[model samples]
Target: MTSKRVFIYAGGEIDPISIKSIKQDDYIIGADRGALFLVDNGIKPHISVGDFDSVNAEEFARIQGFSDEILSCDAVNKDLTDTELAFDIAIEQQPTEIIMVGVSGSRLDHTLGNIHMLLRGLEQQISCFIWDRNNYITLTDSTHIVEDRGYTYASLLALSPEVTGINLEGFLYPLENATLKMGQSLGVSNRLVEAKGTIHIASGLLLVIQSKD
Candidate 1:
């Protein structure tokens, strides 16, 4: 089956490159003030969702006018964050992959929470990642290939208590059947020397983060 990509934009510091990366057929969801950002950029969102607490009445009107559908909630009574709401809607679309942008910003709490959200897609066997101008983050439960996408560094961290039977190939610092434990910096600042690198893990969850300064 052909892959369906869903892009979710949250009310964080957005990368213009991410906005430009959207294709004609890719689905777009704007969360809260992200809706205003999309409409202001001349791209109408397929769906706009959130309590819209971050936007004023005029901005909210613009979002309503530009979005095909709006899922609104009470700002003071909602459980999930605006970004989570958008993520839920994206999952409902049964997308083969999901790319989340504008999810990382000055707010460390929200940024970390959004990073944990990748687990939701991982649990469903969907390819999911959080992308920003400076970082690309993904959680993996199995082996995978990583490409040199011009990022300065590739770091691997154990999301579970420990990731065992791990192997790293095509990287400047290769590993053989190693184990990575949570809170360890052993996998930090690794360089992908080849055109493509391999990350093979036997068990437990791992977070692969490609970042640049």
Candidate 2:
């Protein structure tokens, strides 16, 4: 089987540790200023897409030459955010999975907006995630198995009315056949007890967040 292609978004406030975690084989998609982040980190993206609002003139000029392809858009436009536009391009490439970085931090509203994009990807059955220094977030509607490495902590939150028949194993606190409601904090701060764990939800959509110190 072919390995999944991982797409990284260049946003502001990207953790260097997260950038290092990117393997040499992973694909990269830069969004506006995110392209600048890749250049600073000594990595050239496979494709760069967005309006060059956050990027300064010099940085934008530099990356324009390094990227495999550049898809420029108007700085002020309707329809989708720059990040979403980049994601659309990523989906077209048919990556097995996508990881968005530099997406969370500095602006709470923008972070929330990107999180909603994960929901949209979930609707398309695309395996997508949002990552930063302390958090790993994903949206899911069906049963999924999450492998726990010792690096981060994990939790599940209901995005819909209620998530039913939820099962969690190999964690500090495990739950079975439980119901998680929206706006509740019942599933927060769960740690992996074993090397790996699984989360199974029979119905409804959920947002899974894995964090570390």
Candidate 3:
């Protein structure tokens, strides 16, 4: 399964502590500064896609020596960002899932851009997730199984404006055939009541966030 997974390291805030959850054999793609992050985390990226602008020459050389493939781009007048470019390479592999790290940080614009990548993957019918220390985010148009993995809370939001006939099983605050809207906070910060949690959606897309406070 690791060979079929693609792990993306983006040029955002990274905490090595959270990397323990990542599988060792997944194909790693480094986006700009993420190449350095990979080195710090004791892993060399399989493919690195980025312009050399963000990384210094010496460090870039070090990363190149460690990387299996390096894709260099221009710093000016680029259509896609470094992270987006990495996604292109990951998608080409036709993997089972794409897990992206170092995506959320102080840069609001970049964070929003990272989210668009998830939507694109979703359109491709590929499983995509943006993970951090406390958040495990995934989107689905149908039902999903949620199990207790030490996640303290769970939230469900309508990613497609209107998610109808929503039913949540084994949740502390269960919802039976409820309608979740885009601009609603009714489905935020709910906990699990059992070892397994189940969510059923009849129509529209749903974003499930299993998180720890």
Q: Candidates' TM-scores? A: 0.97, 0.92, 0.91
- Model 1, 1-213: lDDT tens digits are 788999999899788888877999999999998888899999889999999989999999999999999999999998999999999999998989999989999999999999999999998888998988899899998897888889999999999999999999999999999999999999999999999999999999999999999
TM-score between model 3 and native: 0.91
lDDT of 3 at 121: 86
Question: Model 1: runs farther than 4 Å from truth?
Answer: none
The candidate, 1 or 2, that scores higher on TM-score is 1
lDDT preference between candidates 1 and 2, better one: 1
Better of 2 and 3 by TM-score: 2
Tens digits of lDDT, candidate 2, 1-213: 466666667575676777767888888888988888887778889888888888888989988988998988887765787888887887776767888988888788888898888876776667898877788788888766666644567878898999999988777898989999999999988888887778888999889888888
RMSD of each predicted structure: 1.0, 1.7, 2.0
Where does model 3 exceed 4 Å of error?
Answer: 1-3
Clashes of each: 0, 1, 0
